[model samples]
Target: MLAFVLLMAVVGIATPQQFWPSLSFVGNSLADIAPFLLLSIAIAAGVKATGADQLIGAAFRANAGKAVMVAALVGALSPFCSCGVVPLIAALLAAGVPLGPVMAFWLASPVIDPEMMLVTAGVLGVEFTVAKTLSAIVIGAVGGYATVAIQKAGGFSDPLRGIEVSTCGTSAITKPAKPHWKFWDDKDRMKDFVGEFRRTGWFLLKWLSIAFLLEGLMTNNLPMDNIGQTLAGLGLWSIPAAAFVGVPAYLNGYAAIPLADTLMQMGLSKGAALSFMVGGGITCIPAMVAVKAMTRLPVFLTYVAIALTGSVAVGLLYALWGGVIG
Candidate 1:
C-alpha cells in the first residue's frame, strides 16, 4: 500500500504540477513514522518471549481481582501499542488467565501505553493525550471489574478447561550455550533471553507484516475523504459506526493514527475517530479468529463485548468534551 500510495501520488503530481507537493507531503509522512511501527513489533516480540506475559498471567492466576487492577495499571505504564498488546493478550488467555482481566488489559494497553501517549501528545496535543489516558484507565478498570463481577455471577465460564499446558522451561534450558556464562549455574540469562527473542520475534514478525500490508492498502485505496464526509454529522452514532467500519478493515492501532488525523481534520469528532482507531486495532476478524481457536464462544464474545463497550465509551466521552469545548 505504501508503494501504491507513492505511485499514485507521483502520477497525480506529474499530471498536475500543483500536486507535486502532495507527493513530498505523503512520502515524508510515511517515512517519518515507519520506524516506530518496526520498533513496536520488536518490543512486542521481546516482551512476549521474555516471559513478561507469563509473569503477568501467573500474577493474575494468584488473585483475580487484584490481578485485574494490576493489569490495568501495568498496561498504563507499558509502552506497548495496540498491536503489541494482541500477542500478550493471547498469551495470557492461553495461560488460563481469566477473561475479565484480559479484557481489561486489552482495553487499557493501547490507550494508556507510554509510547502511544507520547505519540498522541504529538499528534493530537497534550490535552487529548491526557483525556485518552484517563479515559482508558477508567474504562479498563470498570470493564475489568465488571467482567469479573459478571463471571462470578456465573455469566461466563472457563473456555480452556481441557487444554494442556505446554512447558517452555525445558526448551529454555537446552537451546544453546552462550558466552559470558558464569562457571556456576543460574548465570545464563543472556542465552535464555536470546532464545526467547528468537521465538517471540518470529511470532511478532508474521503478524506485523500482515498488519503493515493491510494498513498500506487502506491508506492507499480507502476513500478517506468520502468516509470523512459521510460520517461528519452523525455524532453519537460515530462511535459504533467507526467500530463497525474498523472490524473488517483490520488495521493495526499505529497504522490507524494517520487515518485518525485525517478524519479529525475533516470534521469527524475526535471521540468517534479515537474509538474507531482503538476498535480497529484491538478487535478484528483475525484477532477474533485467533481467540476463538484458543478458547470457546462465551469467552470470545466476552472480549468482543468489553472492547466494543470501552471503545463506545471513549467515543462518547470525546463527544461530550467536544460539545462542551466547542
Candidate 2:
C-alpha cells in the first residue's frame, strides 16, 4: 500500500505537496507513540525473560475453554503491539499452548491498552472509550471460542503449513517442567532477553514504519466526507459497510478516534463508528502481516473472518439500540 501510494505520487496522480501532510502525520504519530512503544517492548521482554510464558502455557494447557476468557482479559491489560506480540505467540505455540486462548490474546492485544484507553477517553469521550474497551474483550473471547468450536468440529486440525515448530531458545520440544522463575538472573537468560527484545523491536519498527507511512498517505488523500455521508443513518447495510470499508480504509486505532468523532459529528451512525474501530484495529495491515507469518492460510483466513463477523455483529447490536446510545 505504501509503495502504491508512492507510485501515485511519482506518476502525477498525486502531487508532491500532497505528501507534506503525510510526512507531518507520520512524524507526529511516531512522536506520540514512541515512548509507549518502548515501554511495551521492555515489558514484553521482561515477560519472556522471567519465564512468564511457561506460566501462561500451563494455564492454556490446563483448560482451553476457561483459558480463552482469561487470555482475553490479559490481552486487554497488556500493551504489546502486534509485532511485539508475535514472538510471544510463537513461543507459546511452540511450547504447546492451546490455540484457542492464544488466538484470543493475539486478537485483543493490539486493539486497546492502558495508554490507548486514556487517549480514547480524552479524545472520543468516556462512553465511547468504555464501549471500545469492552468491545476488545468481547471480540477476543468470541474469536477464541469460535476457533475452539470450529476445531472441535474438525476444522483447523493442522493450522500450520510449511512453518517449522521449534522451541525458541533451548530445544525443539519444550518440556512440561517448570521454568526457572528467576531465569533472568543467569547471564544466558539476560542474553536471551536482549536477543528477544532486538528481534521483536526490530520487527515492529520495520512493519509499523511502513504501516504508518501508508496511514499518512491515506489520511491526506482519502476523501472521508463520502464515507461519513454514506454511513449516515443507513439502517442495516451501514454496519457491514463500515466493517468492510474499515479493513482497507482505516489508518490506525489512535488516528481513528478523532476521525470517528469528526464523522459522528457529521452524522455518521454510532454503530458504524464502533464497527469501523473494531474491524480496523484488529485486522490492520501490520497486524495481518504479523499473523500471516506465524499462521497457515486456513488460520489466517479464519482470523480475518472472525474479526469481520464480530465487528458486524457488534455494530448491528449497537445500532439496534441507537435510540438510547445515540
Candidate 3:
C-alpha cells in the first residue's frame, strides 16, 4: 500500500498542476471529518478500556435467543473492526458461548460503528449512514436467530468440533480486566489506553487518507459519468452485481466509503450502493478468513450463505421502499 501511494505520488509530481485539485479534495475531506473522527476514536477507546466488550460477551452465557439478541446489538453498536473482533470471537466460542451469538457478532462487527457512521455521514449523507446502521443490526439479528434455528434442527452436530481452546491465543485480548477509566488511578490501563488510541487513530488515518486520495484522483481524472452509466444501466442486476463483485474485491470499510460516494455521484442507485457496502464490508476477505479459522466447515459455509442472503435481501428492500422511507 505504501509503495502504491509512493507510485501515485510520483505520478502526481509529474503532473503537478493537475494533481493540485486532488490534494485540495483530500484536504477538504480531512478538514470535514477530523472532529467527528477524533470524537469517535475517544468513545471507542473508552468503551474498550472500560471492559464493556467483555461484559457484553459475558452476558451471552445464557439462553440462546436472548444471547443472540444481545450479541447482535453489541456487534452493531461497538466500534470493533474485523481484525479487532476476531480474538473476541475466538474467546467466546472457546469458552462455551454458543455459536449462534458468536456468529451474529462476527457478521455485524465490521459493517458499521459510531466512527464509521460519523465518517459516512461526513462523506456520504445522514440517510445512507442511518440505513446502513439499521441494516447492520438487522443482519446481525437475523444471522444469529437463523444460526439458532439451524442448530436446533440438527444442522450442526458439534459446532466447535475441530476448534480448540488453545487456538484462542489468550483471554487477555478478548476479555481485558475491568478497567479504571480515571487516567491516574490505573497507570497500566492508562498506558494501554494511550497505546490503543495511538494504534486506532493511526489505522483510521492511514486508510481514510488513502481513501480520500483515491477519491480525489478518481474525481479529477476519471470520466465518472461514463463508468456510472455502465453500472447504473444494469437496473435490477446492479444490486446483485454489486454484492457479488464486492465479496471478492472488497477493500476495508473506511476505504469503501469514499469509493461508494464517487460511484453514487456517477449514477449508482441507492440500493446498489447499500448492497456493495453490505457485501464488501461484511464478507471482506479478512473477516471471512477470521470466521473460517474459528469454525468448522459447515459453520463457515453457513456464515457465508447468511452474509450473501442478508446483503441481497436488504438491498432489495431498500430499492423497493427507499423513497417512501426517506
Q: 213, model 3: CA deviation in Å? A: 21
What's the ranking of the predictions by lDDT, best on top? Answer: 2, 3, 1
Candidate 1 per-residue lDDT over residues 1-326, each given as its tens digit: 45545655665665454345444544454355345445654443444445454454555665787877877877767776555555556556655577778777766776556776777778878877776677667667877898888888987765553343333333333332223323224345445545544654455444444444334444555676787777777767877888767665545555566777888887887888777766665575445544554567877777778777777777787778878989
User: What's the CA RMSD of model 3 in angstroms?
Assistant: 7.7
Candidate 3 per-residue lDDT, tens place, 1-326, comes to: 48436846875878877566766765787676566566656655554555454444444544678888788889988876765675456546644567788888888888898888999999988988888888888898999999888888888766764444322223333553554557436676576567656766665555555555654554466554565567788988888877876665566689889888888887788898898899778887656755665567898888888888888888888888876776
Q: Each prediction's TM-score against the native?
A: 0.66, 0.80, 0.65
| lDDT of candidate model 1 versus the reference | 0.62
Give the lowest summed-lDDT range of ten residues in model 2: 163-172
Give the candidates in order of TM-score, highest first: 2, 1, 3
Badly placed stretches (over 4 Å) of model 3 are 1-59, 165-229
Clash count for candidate 3 is 0
**What are the lDDT scores of the predictions, listed in order?**
0.62, 0.75, 0.71
Worst 10 residues of 1 by lDDT: 175-184
- By the TM-score metric, which is better: model 1 or model 3? 1
Identify the candidate with maximal TM-score: 2
